[model samples]
Target: MAPVSHAADRVQSLDVYLNACKIGTIVRTPGDFNAFSLDPAYRATGGTPVLSLSLRAATGGLRRDPRPLAGALPAFFANLLPEEKLREAMEKHHAASVRPGNDFDLLAALGADLPGAVRVVPTEGARAVASAQAPQPPRLRFSLAGVQMKLSVMKNTGKGGGLTLPLEDGQGQYIAKFPSLTFPGVAENEYANLALAAALGMDVPARELVDKADFEGIPEEFDTLSDGKVLLVKRFDRGQGGRRRHIEDFAQVFGLYPSRKYDGAAYHDIAAALTMAVSPAAALDFVRRLALCAVTGNGDMHLKNWSLIYPEGDGPPALSPIYDMLSTVPYLPADGMALTLGGERSFKALTPSRWKAFANRARLPEPAVLAAVAATAARVNAEWWHLPERAAIPAAVLARIDRHITLMLPILAECGAG
Candidate 1:
């Protein structure tokens, strides 16, 4: 097990990496903000940068000497760590009870493996993982991004497509998500939803449902799901040979707290974010994604669901592959959309006129936006009708989705999408 460190004073500086190559450094300043600066070596030989180290492209854009970031840490660094609730398993089984809200401290504790290549340890323990290649003891502990409970495991090319092996301290190429005990068949639902998105030409990561019984050994922590299937999603951020890709969710990019992800931001704000941080071409992709989300009944596409991927870490930014796509309307009939569209919270109110007005407000080409909305709605509706049986979606869930689509047909027609 990795030793947990909470001494905020012990951390002085953090080295950041991209694809296992050093890119920058973060210095600690207790009781104040953390300071980050691009490594002079990295900045000197920079070819094409994607990560954008901060919201400002150049150090001159920031008034601070070293570009001190928000949330007591850099926005990007804070995003590397998962939501507070998502770390319960790590705290309960592996670490100190004291909740060190400081992200630098948490990064110090889990030094060996993290989401991206931006690995950090105290300058002293930074070289602590020399024996990382050795096989580790089996344990029922894990750390993953997002607020959901998930574990990182692997499936090799052996018999039965290889049994699920917990990554231990090594990085995992696939993330295993257990079905929600309170909501039966959620794993299957997410798998089917993601598969549908991929079929619709959305850039989605590969995912599938793995039967729990296929595993020769099941961890005790996952005993509640022994009778069902678990969703295995390929981590888009991690690639072949354990290389890590950089990514930032909308919440982090906008400098909003996870608690305020839905309360403060709307869909247009996301489009506007793309306009400023990325290019107009990338903004058009957001249009198709938003339109598809409307037809798919994925009402829970909150700020955290959308992300900007830095393929080369310091290269140009593009929309990240979609994940966490599911029909939330079925489970929470009482809940509405997580964020508003064109100041309209009611999905039924999104008429053609409303969308046209949204396009004008977001400064996107009205014709392109309209065409994308009409085309995507038509395509997704037709494809959704044929997905239930093929994806093995539960009959009851399929029925709800069918009804949900029916409910949105009139709305789509009002928008001249039919």
Candidate 2:
């Protein structure tokens, strides 16, 4: 790809790599928009690394011409940057490389350690193999999506197992999520919700709670915000010996920008995508998770929270392990789901008929969908009712969860769950 001269310091084009194989170039067009084009050889090759489902054509080949995206980077690349508070911190920390509100410079500054196996680099950089094991972390060179304040950290191998910042050259194995100043007991809420999901048979990632003191070399600003503890969640995208596995969220799968993550999509759209891109079984698992979220009062299951992982860095993607689940009722008393389910957003409106409607819209078997929902509701009822006191759930949050479950019972019974 040839670069067109726009400005002296502006980046004209970026080379995109997936699983360490060069696949395409994101070029700056004359209209001031950025567009991606797959490399001819990479597109023609068989069994190559997968970029994204949204970019793939019906013939199973990468599309030659995609609509140019507005702004400095395409939607896929823009979704890779940190959002809100974290984005501001990153811009200030790497001011020399990234200008405020500039997505291109931000990607160039920390391209090597993005969320999935994909990396976007200036065309002149050396080809990067994502699976190569580096001894140290990339030294605050990584960026994770979402508005929450978190850091990529590694758990120490010693007796105490303290969490430490990654030094250089590698991705952090865990994400350290601190408490929120505005929302009390946020970390504990998520921990309890995830625990309940796990008990109800969802494939959740390993997680634990750690004191702020347990973190070594954390930034000073986090100290002033939440309480003295944080939650440490293991990253599923990294496998044996820290090898990178490719993944893409629903936002990227639908080719939508992060700004529109909660809008323009419904639960049926998600189920449809799962059925088409992954499998019927994956879509059914989604129904179970959706029912569980409703029972637990989790109102934030947005597009970005759901993902698909390519285990072998190629085709046949599967639903990713659950992450970022929590009860929003404690914070928002009348909280509803992030996306509409069967023409409704209220958890209380998720009746048997609504689920049936969702199944019909998605072309899934109605009987299987209702069964998944009912089974999930029953499991949550059993698991939460018998949870030990040692779970340390905040009093108000636990009470709220119990109240929501009770509210779901009458409706759940109609769906064959009691």
Candidate 3:
């Protein structure tokens, strides 16, 4: 392995260490913030409480943490230390001898002491490991959180690479997402978008940006090493009242009920999942989401990016909230969406007739769905400018985003009319 870069070395030094012995044990009553006994032999080393970690179950057969060293810093960092003090410490610890291009062995070094079942392989040029199947030491570990809980990391394949993990905290579940490199002034764009969506009464997952350093015993990967930053988001699998449910991507949902498949064919469009809900009301909710995505200029919307949660019960399935909602048009160099809209990839091809046809094929009530779409578009347009101001996005970037939104506004308006 190449020498660890100054930035990676600093991150490694501050990463939290997880006690493998606690892999399948429940943390007893919280005591001393960080000191929680997962088992007699294993315990989490931290001065702050654990909000959550993403792990997978042994039975499900998912790859354990494919990149174990890429842990997010604990949220307690900001609360525990002053910003200037933390920055100074980081600067002092930065590895001055290491070069920028050196491949840092973060996961390998960190996982050396971990159990055999978990692997942490380091990627030569990338910040994160690709997969265990790749010709490298396993960089990630999928370990049981408790007897009944598991955790695993999910990467954001967006232009800005980020990390997210599904954490099952006893009967409660939440997703934790990390921050990624962005333009200097757009630091808090994700947080602002989430807050604004919440204000619009969207059922979004609970999210917060936290400092990783405050938490004691957290892995170094989670903290801000060098110039990189991280954020954490709670999973939506577990709901209030101790409800535990299975999370299925749109593809999985469609595959489960073949009868509801579109025209006896696999429904690859995410909109199909929203339209297939048994309740008309739920279908209408999806229409609102589609309009919101368009109005917000989230052009990267695709089937894989969305999911449907099937709670363990007889309740009807509902649409997951609008996530990955950054202004993709401005951020990405692509001219079209990841998935074709209205059977075409060209934005000009997304005509009102095509949308109406889509609604009809999805079995959605035209009037109700159109009304919801119009309402959501109006709300997003009205609130679009507020997000940049609140997030402190640079005026130049904000103007660029505004221009893209303006160009797409007419198309969004047409979708609402269908």
Candidate 4:
């Protein structure tokens, strides 16, 4: 993969790496178009495909030609960078990286120290990861797309257990989320909902809902109320001792930007992508999670919330540990499922026929599809109902959940019929 030369440090190419080994190069053509090609040696090494199914051909390698992306970074490289306010913050911190109408330069700025093993180094000198020079609190607008206000943080060792503070530039070990003024009891709401998903046997990350008083150096706006709760979630993409493992959300996998994250992809497309890119077991896991999302009345499983994880050395990717698992039914009472399933987005209308269509669309074996559906339905019936109340979820929010349960009964009924 030889890089073409350009005039006066225009940054036309970037070297791509998986861990320590160089894998490929991404280039910005004369017209600000993004194109990519893998190292011929890298493909021969029995290493897993770096980009996703959309970019790489079905035979498991990048297409013979370099191609421009339809959305953000080449499907594999997009989510490695931050989004929304985090994007704004990173841009403000590294002013040189932001050139109007140039996407590749912005990528070059955020490429160093990305989420997973994949690193993007500019044709120039090594780039510093985008972050504040020192650890800073939630001073910059902390709001992201979600209703709840959240920030990237590290587990604070100074106060010992049950304390976390802002993490900047360096690898963040956790994500700190606070209650919502619009949605009351969201901390407890998300906590109880995540617990339900865990009971159904998902690889959920570590999370705890703590009293607001336990944290220090945080802006009071984090929790909205002085006595509210704060949710501290361990970063699944970061391993022991802050090592960065490779991870990419469905948004990045499909080459969609954050603005298009919700509308750009559908659940059927996600399932199809998983079947081609990952193992049979990993594909089955995706089916199971989709089933759980339907029964739980979670209408917010957008592209950003779904992700894939790659193991250390050479290994095929698998669905990452589930994060952002919360039931939005209580808050967005009028909303339906975030992404469409089998040509429809309504949970109530996802009949067995549609599910079978989804299975066929995903190219999944009928037996595996049936098994995943059965497992999810049985688990929800056995373990879901009592969770929120037992978790001591607030009464008003619990009532909304109860109402959502009544509304979502059709999905459970369909599963029970099978």
Q: CA lDDT, every prediction? A: 0.67, 0.79, 0.41, 0.67
Worst 10 residues of 3 by lDDT: 25-34
Model 2, runs deviating above 4 Å: 1-12, 28-33, 67-70, 125-139, 158-161, 221-224, 313-315
Q: Which is the better candidate, 1 or 2, if ranked by lDDT?
A: 2
Model 1, span 121-182: residue lDDT tens: 55545333323444334443334557666677777676557556554455677887776666
Instruction: Quote each prediction's TM-score.
Output: 0.83, 0.90, 0.52, 0.78
**Candidate number achieving the greatest TM-score relative to the actual structure:** 2
Model 1 accuracy (lDDT, Cα): 0.67
Which of 2 and 3 is ahead in TM-score?
2
lDDT of 2: 0.79
Q: What residue runs in model 1 are displaced by over 4 Å at the alpha carbon? A: 1-13, 27-48, 57-72, 96-102, 125-143, 159-161, 165-169, 215-226, 276-278, 313-315, 388-391
TM-score of model number 4 = 0.78
